[model samples]
Target: MKDWWIYKGDPAVPTDRRLARLAEHRPPWRVFEGKVDPDHKVPSLDDKQYAADRERGAGYLADDAEIDLVNTALLLRRPLLVTGVPGVGKSTLAYSIAEDLGLGPVLRWPITSRATLRDGLYRYDALRRLEDANLTRMQATSDEQLLDAPEAEEGDARPADAVTPPADGIGRYLRLGPLGTAFLPTDRPRVLLVDEIDKCDIDLPGDLLTVLDEGRFDIPELTRLADHRRTVTVGTEDPDVRARITAGRVQCRAFPVVVLTSNGEREFPPAFLRRCIRLTIERPGEDKLRRIIEQRIGAGAAAAAAAPDGLISRFLERRERGELGTDQLLNAVQLRLAGAWTAPDEIGQLAQATLQPLSGPDAT
Candidate 1:
């Protein structure tokens, strides 16, 4: 069986105790009770698949400390803040855990400079709703024209202005964003990957502070309708999945495992940092890199690129000199094995293009 050390913290604490602690740390959000098709639950990897999952070269090998930090975060139900250089698998860690545990598909929010808290919470398609409403009105008019002449005569022709706009369900158009969906209540906790958070504006992290701490957010559009209706079924991140919100609020039953990844481009606020379990993903070593190569491509591919000559060794040397990201190694290997170039001189030129390091003031 694959040893998925989801939690490796505190040898002094009994394993049962750690499990119990994590179970107790449920989110403060409300439960999900709605009429809809059930969610899709992909089974966790079996022994063979698990082995394949681990051996795939792009996988991140967590050190004891990193494993401990992850376990600690799980126990405490805290958001994990992962910082690392590009291509170090900061975001992949989230998917790894989700796949290992069968936590369903991961909900990802890729952050950008213009991204904001509300952007991550929900999206209201007002324009689409309005257009749908107009279409419905036109269809109704067509149906009236097709009615028998006598029936049409019996019904007085009301002015077009008298036509009431169709109620295209507003909640139908409002879909939960990745962050909001993660806070949704469910039988099992979901995994949310917020990628490249450091690319967001300075206030983005601070804005998330409250939502993370509270584990909930409200949709005012739904809230307004809630005054008339007790429950509103709304769209979610999952396809064909709908959740019910009472009085326009969505809260979690268990806090979703939140993985916020950064590229070490910027520092976070103290308050924001305090609420998170921080992990710095160090660059993979030679053995890890070899494993990554084997995992990503195939063992045969790896052997083909690595046999006779020290391909992996040379790649590591370039990395040691801060020439390129670890992904470049994979690129180089793939090129070598594919017989892209047979001449040694041409291969070296290809390597130069593939492994060029960052230059200028930022180069280090």
Candidate 2:
């Protein structure tokens, strides 16, 4: 993506050399103080804890090919662009990677129509500025009175102990947006989920090229003040600006795991595409579907026993006839189990009613 060697330098190196470089950046896997074995850096489903995470969320069947792609993205420190239909778990890759590396869950930025660069970096606060100005005025007023009244004795403490110059206004308070937070100086890399990028305007994706390539962004508003002043009034998560300045600009300590998802609705600019490794998610196979259903429904044996003879046959018949998808099959099975529908007639009726109409031409 964007010539990985451009900002970060040449990527032409042996596997071991690349891994060594990644280590120097303090990648997420290195910062984890958890049960993840360092010798086996890539945590797989074979690991119990990793399996638990999979169970908690829909797991990515990270086949060997997928692993290679993941490793390449990490080594290059470029964005991984996942494209697939809805419900195929493209966005979940970020979460899984974060969990595998013990970097915690991802910080998600759900793209929308109004999203902009500033929206993803920081938000200005007017209330804090007003309070700061008010405080400054009050202090100035008191100093004026003390100066006008009389002169103090020599060596006496100055009347105005130097007004601490009101705290920087809310405009200086910059809390990291999801993207900003992901770049924050962490002991380990953070995962950033740019979900449904297709929903955003065309220009938004292009705008991200700079920061993504540079591995940093300057919060001019915050940086300008932070560089020159010790304390500035900035917005806080608090309701009142007068309350406190709790947020500040944070710089990146390491590259982050950036995953951007798309629903294949719109194409991105060539420049944007050039900076990402694209992965297309395929629909789950029959066996995978069965496993998913068994995991979700708790009727594994029952569903399997009945599948070959009639249940699966009927399910496929409907699916072949464009009557249902995998989700509906699972839904019907769960309903059958919950209702104790053991007889073929009962099960068929329930499955047909639940799935058949939904896929029909007139359904929508």
Candidate 3:
């Protein structure tokens, strides 16, 4: 149906406003039913970074094809792989969808050269647990040491060190990461942004396949305790929030909206690529660049008119010679408006510094 469109690319829309299709629709491929921890709450949307990200995402000007791809990914329950140069708003798309759909906070997993799949799932501080156990053992005191043995005859009271409780239950040392948090079970899907995924190691992309397909993952640390400690409350990605894991497994009732961004630095495995819905963002044209400026700041602002006239034209002209990101344009505008230099030539030179090419021999 025409009304099936949830994200219409209109920045004016707010959250808590889902279309009938998204509200009633259920993924036919969904097989797991994760039980959410009633006390666990997602981070509040009032954070400063959250506000800035929401604004940037809402202002993103998505074309018709981009919009179609987003909706398609949502219906098919697949990850959206966005490839583009830096500053093209690939990562912001996830925040846009989250804000538009009333998803509380966008779960972000920033990739690095050393990043691994396990790093994004959860962390078990086994060493810290071991240290605490050692400290408890060393601090052992007897009743006679406390002078209680002389005052009152002890019948069954044992030393504090005699009964050490499984290092205070393994849950205290466990915490979920961004990827793990995003897969948490709930009626509505959470938006997950895997930023700069291409920066990860060669194996990371292929490593993500299992969870992407199953919408579930197992925590061996928690699984080991299942025999006795059935439900373990552990820390979540959200600060101060803890969740209960039943039988060491984390499943999802609704698959998260996973958006993986890439700089196209390297090629991905064909098998990994097959599972994702792909979208490519090209450099914004002069007109769209101006729109981005207006969207970020009002067109009437003095900063909008900071650069004399040919600044944008010059930017696009040099873009032909080397790769330049839109952020460089914004930076140049800010530099000009900052009153950093007075002489016209000096001002031009300073602005040029901000608009340097991101790639090519000129980059250095």
Candidate 4:
């Protein structure tokens, strides 16, 4: 099934027409809004953003195994379950794929102890509904009085301005959660990041199996579309000047790129694992670490260049010695730069202070 949304340009076309074109051509499972960040040359990972992302970080070293896993997920149309130590860029893989594929903004669902199927699918905005209910009630009361009064004009029989009774706001207030947003109607492929999935309750992963297998969910609160229908509107935050509206269950015409991350804290049920393509993210090599630091800390032309060689060496040595991980390396670089540490002594002190001794299970 193809995505039906289309874009027609105004007489005066803008320079960012590429963004609109990308949106127009997106597959059913993809969501595309025109350039999210226009100032940044990358255009926020929409179809038009691919070229810029490639130019920016093309040389960064990534493991062939990890790259192959990504390729397999894309080909097989299954969720890629990435298990790894924290700070090893397991979460970053989703963004990297979004950037590489020009898939628009990554929809992230940060799993917590309380995360559930409902939380991943939709979040009810009760405050907005309450305000809307008050407005509708006042409007209805005013209209009743207007109807009771005599009509000012002859044959002006318009049923007291038939107030379109506010839609049943109960279920209408359900807005798409990160997972729901990924399934919403769109023009381009979307990347769904189910981050820290191990942190969620056990049942949550099993609950996702159905959606992962069938790519459709039923919201009984809203009207159902034809069975096996490929698209539905979940809901959207009001765009400027528009009132909040609920879109039905959006079906995907094309499978989405689903990247789920786990920190190896808990084991998923075998059934849950069966529905996904699992991959383990290994620690970064020295070369990859250097590139990561340079990308994040602004190398050469962007800032006063730091001793990238020395910093990376110390970071790797400490990591090998089990004192720090990749996350600390990036943190140390930022802290050192912020503190205006350009000398060897300052770098040593900064690394030691930032990377505390690992304890208990983490040390192993």
Q: Is candidate 1 or candidate 3 better by TM-score?
A: 3
Rank list by TM-score: 3, 1, 4, 2
Residue-wise C-alpha lDDT for candidate 3, range 1-364, written one tens digit per residue? 2355667634354434554356456666755678766666776566765787677667877777788889888877899999999878898788888766767788899999999999999999989899877765654654346545556655656654553546447888999999998887876788889999999999999999999999999999888879988888888887777888889999987789999999999999999999999999888887788877777655753244335544576677678777888777777666656766445556457546766777774532
**Predictions in order: lDDT:** 0.72, 0.61, 0.78, 0.62
Task: Estimate the TM-score of every prediction.
Answer: 0.78, 0.66, 0.86, 0.68
lDDT (tens digit, per residue) of candidate 4 on 52-167: 54444333345767777776666566799999877777777777776555566677889889988988877777787788778778877876676667764555565654545445
As a whole number from 0 to 100, the lDDT of residue 18 in candidate 2 is: 44
Candidate 3 displacement at residue 182 in angstroms? 0.7
Residue-level lDDT tens digits of model 1 in 1-364: 1143445434466555545556655444422332222453323434454455433312555567777777667757789999988877787788776654556677889999999999999999999888877877886777677564555665576546444554536777888888888887765677899999999999999999878887778888888887687677777777667777777887776678899999888888999999999999888777777777887778986675565444576666567676457778888888877777546556566566676665332222
Model 2, 218-256: lDDT tens digits are 656655556455334433221232211112334455578
**Ordered list by lDDT, greatest first:** 3, 1, 4, 2
Lowest lDDT block of 10, candidate 2 = 237-246
> Could you tell me the C-alpha RMSD of candidate 3 in Å?
3.7
Candidate 2 residue 66 Cα shift, in angstroms, is 2.4
Please give the distance, in angstroms, between residue 89's alpha carbon in candidate 1 and its true position after superposition: 1.1
Name the top TM-score candidate.
Answer: 3
